[model samples]
Target: VWHKCVDIVTAGLKRVAEIGTMMPDPHGYRRYCFTPLVAWTADLPEQLMIACVSKSASPVTEATHKQFGDSHSHSSRTGDLTLQRIEQVARGTHPWNNLSRFQREAKTIQLSGVHLPFWRNWPFADPSIFLLPEILHTCHKFFFDHVLSWCRELLEDDLDARFKCHHKRVAVRHFAGGVSHIKQMTGREHRDIQRTIVPMIAGCVPPRFLRAIRAIISFIYQAQSPIHTDTSVKEMESSLQEFHAHKDAIIEANARKTRSAGTKNDFHIPKLELFHSFAAAIRNNSGLIQYTADVSERLLITHCKRPFERTNKNKD
Candidate 1:
């Protein structure tokens, strides 16, 4: 389906470019040719496209055949050919066009047989140009949810007990000058605490956690309402870097606890490895992050869902 769509769009763009049929800008300068920059943005599962392409099966199956010395078990060809790897190649980091570790891996996997159809033609000739990191799912959801999880776990008992009777008062005082009102620390109220309240009570949060919180809010606001200037992009990059640093600090702080917990899953807490996508988005098109942000999707769920439905789901 992606292949077909690309073929049709690429053909149309070429035809219009050749015929000189583009609409003029405000300055009345006619522009005929336009290379459509393709970008794919969705939640992590959809964006990663695990097991979506056919080639993912071949190499693993071949490996199994060699190892077992028995031809009976069909090869289960599945491994990590992540979007990050592809995007790295697109951005000139993964060495797809050169000889390096990435190239070596590509060769080992029989790169020629990789079957992502969009990579075959124009416009999508470069996967990096088309498949972008969506800030909404990548940054907003992960960053905020990670922060929310920590906050809820750390403060839920204390806040509920301490502010049992005066929760509304605290919210009213905090947001007195603003239109917002919060009677309970639930859902968006939790988000609001992370965004607005956390900064105000920075002293209460550990320095490492406070820094991460500030970095996240800064990046999200800047992405949603970008300045559309080079400096703004740089600032976004800086904030993202700071967020990553603080995230590392928090992870390090938890490393000892996680180790002692003796859990097989080493990543006991959320990881900020995906934050690289935010930097990629800044480089590709800084201003466009707003369009792909998670704010709208979150708003849709909050507004569209009926009260009864939410109550029933919670009860179940």
Candidate 2:
């Protein structure tokens, strides 16, 4: 329970002088506090945050200082245009990630939140789609690392913290184990699956490449080896670290409350208990440091996959 003035914020003080001061609100402060840990939290697109801060600043001059900032007089023309660029990007990339156009036309498709933003942009729609192989490779490696890391721990409970990669893309992921090899049999079978899944792949590939990927998934589901993805193992770790930091913030807040008010805040005491319970839940879910099956299943089961898979066959 940190008192309001306890200043529990403990991230990116180093870049402070460069990015400019945070807005005077709690969320602004929270976002500012979370900045250095971006590699860890993996939240917000690059450059967009600087844009967000600029947008949030109450007085335009203060916002300008926060944006192009650390530059000469806030009145100067140089900082104005420089700060304006980030806004331009956010505005431009908007359509790339949203699927409403297709859905509105009765496409009636659902893209995963993870892929939705990406699909709204360029490479995702261009069919000439770049990074197909990279995406596959990364997904495969992410699953493999977490699965093996998990298996090792199961075989030897003496160990904790099994993941190794600290990269951004993969660490934020949740990959189900064992599904790596499950494959569809026919081209038609895969075609149907593709109709359903291709959108989730974030429109990040050409039709021809997407077809090829479907073939690969089918073959592997029926075979032994696994296909990888473009996302890195490091990303998964980064996500967990971010999650932990968030959890830690909640814990700190509760601790501060207890100290700040003592008996003065009895009316809201139950809310405090609920907050502690929430923090405990996150702690119980302590993210995997080395990949593991249990964690993988928990993380990978998205909103779409209501009938989640749990095959003990994977252990074999």
Candidate 3:
């Protein structure tokens, strides 16, 4: 159903890409304008759906959960390769020409059974390439979801006490009741927590674990920079490497846990794997700041929420 909706929407885009449209420039001179999908800004789950890759597999790289924590770079996943895999499933013969077999084959390649993706027919649009990183969901949400949870497990009541004791300053959020009591946290709150979290848990967690937290915090801040250079990007990558190096301390402290197995510990986080593509994304698409969802989130409150509130509750 979702793919059908995508097909309906992209049909026009496909036509526009093929037959160029004429538009005026700043000087009012009419010129042929060809629209190609340069970048797609979405949260990780939506990105996986649009790119037709499974959660365990990355759309940007060939790496799966097993290789997610590995420091080595993985081979890129290309549109041509994705299309070819879909084609193979569609044209399978004999024993492979069944629904179960098709699903199994697709799973092996970390692809969903989305045989005909909307972007398949679109010109110069590669899902792997165009699906850019979003800082809000990728960094801020991950911190709250994984990092904060890990810290909470290790620190427990002490964590909250530290936050409660921290002196309040101008422009800084004061979590008077501490983080655990907060029902819902906004992006701004997440940013506020990031600012103070490293020092808040300094003496409580192991030295290696503290280093890991510090490194990830560094990476998150660096990624949000409005301007990025080759040197800056390398520094970002180094921070990620540093985090990966010391992440074992998290497991040793019994902070990280597997939801499925309940006892096993591993760093098979999709967001962690997604970090590997940030350098390439920054180089390909200008700065990471441009891809942030902050502006759009604000616009949602202004354009959607406010208007809905203003509207009368009627069928009309």
TM-score to native of every candidate shown: 0.54, 0.17, 0.90
lDDT of 2 at 177: 27
Report the lDDT tens digits of candidate 2 across residue range 275-297.
11111112322321222233434
- Order the candidates by lDDT, highest first: 3, 1, 2
Q: How many pairs in model 1 have backbone atoms within 3 A of each other, for residues 3 or more apart or on separate chains, i.e. clashes?
A: 2
Q: Could you give me the TM-score of model 2 versus the true structure?
A: 0.17
Clashes of each: 2, 44, 0
Q: Which stretches of candidate 3 lie over 4 Å from their true place?
A: 93-101, 258-263, 301-316
Ranking by TM-score: 3, 1, 2
Question: Which candidate ranks first by TM-score, i.e. highest?
Answer: 3
lDDT against true structure, model 3: 0.86
RMSD of 3: 2.9
* Model 1: residues with Cα > 4 Å off, grouped in runs: 1-31, 50-116, 159-191, 252-271, 277-280, 293-316
Q: Model 1 clash pairs?
A: 38-130, 136-294
lDDT agreement with native, every candidate: 0.47, 0.27, 0.86
The digit string of per-residue lDDT tens for model 1 on 1-316 reads 5545665766766455345466788899976656454455555444333223222222223321133222122333223333334444445533435546544454443342223344343432333334455555555565445555454434444443333333355444343333122323433444455455454535555787678768867876676555466777668767867765665544544422222453221222212433434444556655555557466566666776655565657654
Q: Is candidate 1 or candidate 2 better by TM-score?
A: 1
Which candidate has the highest lDDT of all?
A: 3
- In candidate 2, which residue ranges exceed 4 Å CA deviation? 1-12, 15-38, 41-83, 86-316
Error of 1 at 97 (Å): 27
